[model samples]
Target: MAKGSNCSRWVLCSLVKLVFNDAYISTKIHHRQVSPLRRPPTAAIAGRARVPGFGTRVNRVCVRAVISEGDKKKTMVETSKELNESAVESGGWVDVRAVITIRKKMKENLNEKIEDQWEYVVNGMGQGICLQLISDQIDPVTKSGKSIESYVRGWMPKPLSHPHIVAYMANFKVPHDFGCPGAILITNFHGKEFYLTEIVVHGFKEGPIFFPANSWIHSRKDNPESRIIFKNKAYIPSQTPPGIKDLRREDLLSIRGNGKGERKMHDRIYDYAPYNDLGNPDKGEDLARPVLSGEEMPYPRRCRTGRPPTKSEPFSESRIEKPHPVYVPRDETFEEIKQNTFSAGRLKALLHNLIPSIASALSSSDISFKCFSEIDKLYNDGVVLKDEEQNIIDNQFLGNLMRRVLTAGQQLLKYEIPAIIKSDRFVWLRDNEFARQTLAGGQPKQELHLHRMSVEEAIENKRLFILDYHDMLLPFMERMNSLPGRKAYASRTVFVCTRTDYPYAADGLLIWSAIKELVESYVEHFYPEPGLVTSDLELQAWWNEVKNKGHYDKRNEPWWPKLDTKEDLCGILTTMIWIASGQHAAINFGQYPFGGYVPNRPTLMRKLIPHEDEPEYEKFIHNPQRFFLSSLPTQLQATKVMAVQDTLSTHSPDEEYLGQVHHLQSHCNSDHQVQIMFKKFSSKLEEIEKTINARNKDIRLRNRSGAGIPPYELLLPLSGPGVTGRGIPNSVSI
Candidate 1:
């Protein structure tokens, strides 16, 4: 070899090693995973597998001999040289060329190979539309099969011109010799009816005759391949042929069910109110605009999108605007009381909005209220209250925390007792029998049973026992019962509120075991399809296809690799259960206050924002609206004062807050604070709506330009005709 060629080969080899030997190289061949027993020999001199020579700390030879074009063994260098040369011959980068070749091969494999006469229905825009056709006895002259017009099974792909297009095509007679070639019947001519002026015949051994106007133009019908033609009125025959049939009338009547007419509305089986106001025009306007009438004022209803689906009743309106404001008697006088009563009056209204159950429990005559004290035995045997990370607190800490929250709430209500029922966060009232039984210095087991009885009675009576601090409550119960701590917060809450639901205690082990059994049963009964053979080779082929689709990226970011092992499948199902059961929220809320982090794992829900210019917009949005809703209070409720004088002394109004309150001089002076707060909230909601609208517009624009498919289009019918229900069990445990 010449010196220059030899040097070039040496340089190429060096370059290949530098590029492929690094950690950045994702090729499996470069980073083969070997068994522990068969360790690489170069790894500190134990018996291990290694390339025979040329091993360095940073690099190793990753090439071997492969059979070449003539089935002769070729060294790695020779193979590389040949592949690189072929890539150069094809032009562009080697990877790009390979991708292009694979695509071309796929297209060739997909092309239909048939030997029957086929006709494509072409629209006015020159686009071909397909319909299933059934061919019958062949014509002797054309040697092409003919299909009965009635047996042609397809709805019109789109509206066609009945007066012109359909009438003209029906007048044509099939060519006798060499079979009439496929013909394109043009519809929707000049953006009107599918007129018979333009007809293109293609890919046939012979062509057909057309009759439209009185005149006609004759062409060489024997020629199978001919240029497309647009004939005028001259194409029509002077008189009907003796053997020809007048078929246009039948065609016109048959094509009437093309859905060109308006659709009729059908009555529904169930009478449902048009409650989906977001889509319904009648209600949609009312959402943002208020209705006003004589002697009645208008106000926007509270948007409940973030509230629980179980609650049916609409939230009560604030009584801050009530006709008769509650009077507070101060030596300071009545005028200032009306203005300062704005927050207090609303809080009182919120209390009445509470579901019946909670109202009954809190208002029960037998219930006793107590200030939390150390004598209440609020301590565990060994657990200490500490501000340490991951330190599990016992039931005592929960009780103490509840007391503190209640105390803070009491301090917040500084007005007359009417709003007192709404202001306190937790009502520490228990029925006389339960309080007497539990706090009677009894055994822990007895106390626990008594507590359980109280809870049971409350449930039985449909009375709500609101555990204001459930994140602490459930875990504390788990600790007291000697249950596992990691999933102590996984229990579901039972009580329903505007913002949250009370969780019911659940055993994680039992739940997980049930899940495992269900998954096993489901997979055993339905996972294996008769034709789907998931051998190693098949799986690897699927993986390769997935990777080529641009789905596989760095560390599988933004894409979940197909489940190749039972363990991976189980892990995924575990995550799905965690998310679906809402246990994720329970644990997260328990661990953090006001904020929690969701792990960067695959999720079932995808949120996309097309309007944002940054690629990181989706990550940043993280559904801020939900977070905002949770952080803000939906309703303000008051609590009737218990130990009124003491509570008032401790929570004397701050000068800053007092200064902000509007003074009520005249009876007509309205509580302007409520209006101000409502206006601010409405403005914030409008901003959010604008953002969502902008994103939707961006998505619509993208869909129009074919830049992206709408998310809704990804849905396909889960079950349909020909989707047999056999083999799969009708009832599977879940």
Candidate 2:
């Protein structure tokens, strides 16, 4: 038998026994066809198999062998079934055990995977090596708190070589268990001093990081060692003693310190004291002070006392005090006093004598023969000339002379006369002279027809004269007409006067014409009867028309129609006065006073008359013939009274009387004897009144109605009530 066959037979016999639940080995062999092995095995065989000596000693083994083919097949099938059943029963618990074992092993493997992936530590920082500088508990020599020595000693792994450690004190004191993982000091183990360059936290922690190299702690002089050397293991002193050298050493000692001394030292080093001590003790006194104890101390006394006695007081005999009297010559002194005396006396005399003369000359139709002489001189000197018809021929010369005379006369009248009359001395003199003159005069012949014809002719001649001199008069008239125009002319005169040396007399002439126009207009409007209209509506309409005309235009039609109606005539007169009076006097004198009477009174009859008891009328009537003499100078007296009244009524009592004189002078004519005529008329009227009053005394006593009868009625009494039986009393009774 081949070795493989023998081995197969033995394995089958052993499998049969084991399956059948027998302990004995099966020795019998069934005859079966075996196929030859297809290939030899590669590995060397180790064990030898005993092939039962083919049958030599076939022991009586309890081997069950089936002989029939069918039976053998059945036995084999049953054995296979039984073996399967036994295998199932035996290994059933093994599968369950295996599953359980596998689950437990899987659980262990999962746990190992989790352990490799994640980790946990006490601080939030992952496990890593780190270096930290421990904060100092003590302050440095500069008194900077928290020196670095303490830090190095406490947490450095080894002694430092270049110790550059900065010390930091927390803004708030930190607790011992503030969760700081502690710190490490990076240093050379062998070096005596260590320089701390950087600080790193090993774990999740917070700290005020410090570098020892750049800090005051490492800059100490005495204690030069980099590493902190602890002395006794006693509790580091809570407060460091004053004179520490190295702040790091002080820190190592765990001493408490402040920055007061450090600040003071820094201030000293930097010379940062606000005050300086000069070499002079006096200068330095303000900077330093000696220590004081217990009792209060007074302020330091000044080194120098009060100022040295003045030179004058100490040395009395240096200079003499003498009164210097100014020496004035007798002539100069007397002359000064005389001049002052003359100024006062001259003004008084001038006003006393001149004002009345001027007033008289202006009010009278008679010009001084001397004035006419001057006029003749002007003509002879070729300053003036006359035409063949005996009229003023050189219009320019006439106009110029007229203007000068007029202006000088007007200024003298208006501004100077009132001023002279206001003086008591002037008034006394004027009145006394006037009384004397009146006493010498009496009522003279009536020259009415001659005077009236002369006045009319003069007016007609003047109109023609003005036309001839229109060019010269126009500019002068325009300039004098209004304040604005006057002011413009005044400026022009100033320039012209400077350039051409034209005398102020010429300018004065223009001013005189202006005033003349003003006075004439006033007389026509307010003084004459049939006076200006008093109606406000009429006045406003007139004003509107005048304004619309806007600066008299010779070319344009006249704004004022011909004065046909009495009302229109009155308006024209009123307007004329308004322009003449410079608006101011017109509004007050003419409009307010006269206008108020227009509605009730006959305008022409409103003349100023003397009261019954007045001495003026009686004095005039005493010498009526002399008063009425053709050459008598009554105009000045009239002008004096008028000026006095004007001054009393108006606030400007000191205005010149010469202005009034000039106005009257302008009206003088050769043919008209106005001065004598006016005087005669006045004297005659007074006489008539005196005569009637004297005769009616008894009648007045009997009848109360005729008590205060006016002189006008006395002259024409027979025409009215007093002369007939229907006299004043009867008229009143009726």
| RMSD for each of the candidates | 35.8, 64.2
Residues 1-734, candidate 2: write the lDDT tens digits: 00011112222222211111111111211111111111222321112112221112222111111111223224334533442343211221210000000000112267553532221110012111112223333223334222111111111111122121111111112233323222222212211112222221211222122121111112122232222221111111122222221332322222111111222110101101111111122324343333221134222111111122224232111121245312111111112223343444334333333434533444434232123233223213312212321232224456566546544544333322222112222231332222211211111222233223354564554411111333435566544545421211111110001112111222223333433443344324322344333322223333333322221222144554553344554444334322322232212222211111111111111112234587656644675333223122232333333333232223221121111211111211111233333334334434443444454453432211122221111121112211111111101000
Among all windows of 10 consecutive residues in model 1, the one with the lowest summed lDDT is 96-105
Model 2 bad stretches (over 4 Å): 1-459, 462-580, 583-649, 652-734
Q: What is the lDDT of candidate 2?
A: 0.24
Best by TM-score: 1
> Distance from true position, residue 700, model 2, in Å?
53
Pick by lDDT: which candidate is best?
2
Write candidate 1's Cα lDDT for 249-307 as tens digits: 11112211221222111100001011122222223433332222112332222111121
lDDT of candidate 1?
A: 0.22
For candidate 1, report its TM-score: 0.17
